[model samples]
Target: MASRTAIKRLTVEYKRLQTQPPPYIVAKPLESNLFEWHYILTGPPDSPYEGGEYHGRIVFPNTYPYAPPAIRMITPSGRFATDTRLCLSMSDFHPDSWNPMWSVPTILTGLLSFMLEDTQTTGSIVTTAAQKRQYS
Candidate 1:
């Protein structure tokens, strides 16, 4: 069960997302489970992933706002491994670095920025530009 604080926080975030969505990203929590949210990211223009649509999920811990959520990309973008948890400072992998002030938009924006970079990290994959373009 999700804690009251988690539910309230997620609810407000969802409303904010719907009213003023972030560019290149769309996310929605499941009706049955507020802790789980599915998102689609449109690759930024000019990037190798341009024209591609990546699917992913964010699973928040019940202690959300105080703890980071687990993030995973579900689509093959020649970047991150599909279905594997991504290691980011805003993710559960680095709880010490997470800031409760960060919201859904912040996390998704960070993910998109990181995707455009070539830095290797846990759950990240390496592929040629041609492969990435093809995936896009």
Candidate 2:
């Protein structure tokens, strides 16, 4: 069952996202499930991901704000494996560092910032710049 706090927070965040959407990213909750969100991310310019529009989902826990959500990139970005959960600090992989104050916009921006980095992790992939550019 979803906590009232979780539902309320998600609702407020959804409205904020709709009214004043963030740059390079747009997201919304699934009509049937508030815990499941779909998002579109425009690849940052000057990076291998430039000119690409990546789609993915964020699965929030009922105990969200206390527990981070799972993040998966569905697109074939050479930086991370498709359909695999990313090992990011803001993701469920590192809950200890998560801040309850961080909102959906913060998470998406952080995700995009991390995507531009060349960090290696469990779900991260290693490919040549050319390959990444071509795949983007």
Candidate 3:
């Protein structure tokens, strides 16, 4: 169960996201559970992931803002492993690096930027540009 603070923060974030959505990203919490949010990210132009619409989930801890959330990609983008928790500074894997000021837009924007790069990290996979294009 999410704490009252978590729920309130998430609610405000959701409203802000809807009112001023970020480019290439759309996210919404599950009707049944605010802790579980589903997101869609459209690959940026000129990238191997371009033309792709990747689906993913973010599971927020009960103590959000203070704790990071787990992020996983549901769609195959030839970048990150499907359904696996990605190791990012903003993710639960690196809670020590998480910032309470970081919001949903910030996280998703960072994810898109990372996806455009070839830097190796846990839960990340490497593939040729051609192979990545096929997935796109």
1 against 3, candidate with superior lDDT = 1
lDDT of 1 by residue, 9-67 (tens): 99999999999999899999999999999999998888898999999999999999999
Superposition error at 111 for model 2 (Å): 0.7
Model 1 lowest lDDT segment of ten: 1-10
Best by lDDT: 1
Candidate 1: residue pairs that collide = none
Candidate 3 residue lDDT tens string, 1-136: 6689999999999999999999999999999999899999998898888889999999999999899999999999999999999999999999999999999999999999898899999999999988888988
Better of 1 and 2 by TM-score: 1
Q: After superposition, how far is residue 105 of candidate 2 from its true place, in Å?
A: 0.9
Candidate 2 lDDT by residue in tens digits, 1-136:
8999999999999999999998899999999999999998888788888888889899999998788999999988788898999888888999999898888889999888878888888788999888888877
Full-model lDDT for every candidate = 0.94, 0.90, 0.94
Q: How many clashing residue pairs, candidate 2? A: 0
Error (Å) of candidate 2 at residue 65 is 1.3
Backbone clash pairs for candidate 2 read none
Candidate 1 versus the native: TM-score? 0.97
If both were scored by lDDT, which would come out higher, candidate 2 or candidate 3? 3
Worst 10 residues of 3 by lDDT: 1-10
TM-scores of all predicted structures: 0.97, 0.95, 0.97
